[model samples]
Target: MRVGLYPGTFDPITIGHIDIIRRATALVDRLVIGVAINRDKGPMFSLEERVAMLEAEIAPLQQETGVEIVAHPFENLLIDCAHDVGAGLIIRGLRAVADFEYEYQMVGMNRALDSSVETVFLMADLKHQAIASKLVKEIARLGGDVSKFVTPAVCDALYKRLGR
Candidate 1:
């Protein structure tokens, strides 16, 4: 069915994520937004909260974006998650050289786990490349507005989390 998976911790989904989803939808029949579970890195929002935020953020663009947004807690190996969901392709967005370095290693690791599944890398739209969850959180944490880069869902969650 040409299902593609786009997985990340998504501590908070950003405009970059939405942009990737927008682009990935064009190349595959369906896109599964897999939310990875990080055991070591503590997140501001709970996994459930992050998923809810993602769902709300994507609601308005659900029809217009032409991508199905589904969040899976990738507790197991990511390849297994893809296999479980019948994803033959993995879509990732690259923002810069550093991102490529990290993602390249991940791509290799994913391939080692499942050679049948291919990782497809997409360059982030220039305007959205700098919009990262960590940066967004940092900005919000410091009381800096990130309205242009984050969706309303994320903004609300950020504000709530920051007690603003």
Candidate 2:
């Protein structure tokens, strides 16, 4: 089976993220959405919350695409996580040239760590290209609506967390 890993902080999975997940699942038999728990970044959502949100958000697509999808909470080395999950490819979403520059270096490092695993980049859909988790949270914190950027469930979670 060709398994792919799409890893991200996903403090609150956005529309842009769902777009990437949809595209990635079509390319591989199994696509694992690896939620990275990086405390240094101070994510708005807890690891458990993020995983639950992702699982709920992707459930419909999983059924629609007939693609095996799972939420994995991971820490430590990303390459090691890919190896652990038996992933042959790592799926990444690129929104702009700046994203490619950072992802390019990370891809090189990941390749060095595990040459057997390949990396694939999928461009974000035009509508969601400007959406990002950080910006979404910022907008919500300031009482701005983020419904366009995220799902209704995520919007509720943001409100619950931000005490809106």
Worst 10 residues of 1 by lDDT: 65-74
For each candidate, what TM-score against the reference?
0.94, 0.98
Worst 10 residues of 2 by lDDT: 76-85
Candidate 2 structure quality by residue, lDDT tens digits, 1-164: 99999999998999999999999988999999999999999998889999999999999999999999999999979999998899999999999999999999999999898899999999999998899999999999999999999999999999999888
Q: What is the per-residue lDDT of model 1 for residues 71-120, given as tens digits with 9 covering 90 to 100?
A: 67777888998998999999989999999999999988988887999999
For model 2 the local lDDT of residue 52 reads 94
Residue-level error in angstroms, candidate 2, position 98: 0.5
Candidate 1: global Cα-lDDT?
0.85
lDDT for 39 (candidate 2): 94
